[model samples]
Target: MLASFDIGALGHSFWALTISGLTYGSIYALVAVGYTLVYGVLRLINFAHSEIFMLGMFGQYAALMMFGFAPQGDAYDMGVAQTLMYLGLAMIGGMVVSGAAAVGLERVAYRPLRRRGAPALVFLITAIGASFVLQEFVHFVLPKLTNNTLGGLNAQQPIRLVSPSTQFTIFGATVTNVDIAIVVSALALAFATDRFINGTKFGRGIRSVAQDPVTATLMGVSRERVIMLTFLIGGVLAGAAALLYTLRVPNGIIYNGGFILGIKAFCAAVLGGIGNLRGALLGGLLLGVMEMYGQTVFGNEWRDVVAFVVLVLVLMFRPTGILGESLGRARA
Candidate 1:
């Protein structure tokens, strides 16, 4: 792959790749938070979380459809105000769907198992099973319900809410309006989440529970509520990410769309230190940039391999990750 590589192209598109990488990384960071938060509190991977992200994608699509948007034909060119309004509604729809799915998963699958004092293996199996069930439900059942419009094994085209018009240029790279919206909005949400996790009474409860559930429970923190809240936050972020993702890949919305991204996001969480929020952001940006650079150097076909290789090398050196796992120390 390296033999045919155009090294000069890498230099020429350095800024462009970096910008695109950051955009992709922002989405990864958003999704990674869901994994990290759930892991921190429950010490479980919550494998079904990816499906939650997938559901968010459909939720936003469905919302737009309800607003008179269609899968194909001429793209909508509504005024800026109307476009933002529709986008906002779509995001809210995504959040509600993803949040409800997450909570339901916990209540129906994990919570009952936890109450029964099930082993770690049982929880892991259940999570994996739940993930498949959700995906298949979307794949086989949802398409039928939407008259083959929203779901199924086929990829659904999202209504183009934001046209990717070039907004600015930096260091020879042209940035689009969608790029700015995705990066800025994702950063804002990440910052707000960090603040909420570190600055609120509920945030304290979450950290306390993550540190020690028994002690936190004794101290009057409701474990169930904290778990629910963590899932809700994760879902909301994922929902927002779904909107941003649609902006990036309008034709890429499908049941399996979230699978690879979800894996990458999980990799990002581990790369950043699985339980660390700031680490997820850092890891995501780093991974995205590195993956883009890898594509430039190793060719597009090797991009995914390069990403996983980097992950392995990082783990070989620092298993705890770049910042280390410490939900408790995050506030400090």
Candidate 2:
């Protein structure tokens, strides 16, 4: 087992792995933000959040289909201008669907429990059950709803929007347009989210509720409103991540596609500090980079193992995570 490990691969492809890792890390960071945000406000794990991500994938694909772009083996050859327009539209479509679904999930699955003063364990179980319900809906119901055009047992044929082309080289690693786009878009969204959370009045409300729900309620902060906003924001970001993810892996939009990725994102949230926004970002990038390195050294098959092991080791040493800060304690 020791001899099978190839440490030299990391030395040879350090830059390559780093760039690739950052690209994936960006996606993970976006999805992990949702996990962190929901946990911060509700202290709920939101296991069904991954299913929301999956729906966003399908939502964006449907948007493309509505635009007359059929699923095919190759990407559309439209000019950069048209491609950007369609991509923007697709992103919007995903965001809307995901945002609405998130709100609905809160209303249908969680709000009733909240009214009943359900235990934390009940909420967690509901989240898991909701996740299965969403997945199965897509697996069985979506096909019938869409006349078999959208979701089923297999991955939808890829509808590529931007074909990757090498744009530059860093050290010895090549960077593509897709890599640049994913990283830049993710950073922009994250920055915007941070600013909104820290600077806006609504954001203050969220923080207040998170820090002390009873006090925040006494201060006239509507807990329900804050919770809804949290879910919306998280869902929108997940939708954006879904688009970026599809750009990187076009054929990844299956009914159960979000399962592993969602788990990784949750691990990222825990790794960084579950309720901390900045921590989620940091944890995701670190997880992505480390996972890439582990895959390189151990083999592709070890990728998932590497991610889980990192989570376990982190939990063993620092249960509160790397940052060990809660969202309520975050500085403005």
In model 1, the clashing pairs are none
- TM-score, every prediction: 0.97, 0.98
> lDDT (CA) for every model shown?
0.89, 0.93
Clashes by residue pair, model 2: none
lDDT for predicted candidate 1 compared with the true structure: 0.89
Per-residue CA lDDT of model 2 for 116-208, tens digit only, reads 999999999999999999999999999999999999999999999999999999996899999999999999999999989999999999999
Positional deviation of residue 127's Cα in model 1 after best superposition, in angstroms: 1.6
Clashes of each: 0, 0
Q: Which segments of candidate 1 are over 4 A away from where they belong? A: 1-3, 330-332
In terms of TM-score, the best-performing candidate is 2
Query: Distance from true position, residue 175, model 2, in Å?
Result: 0.3
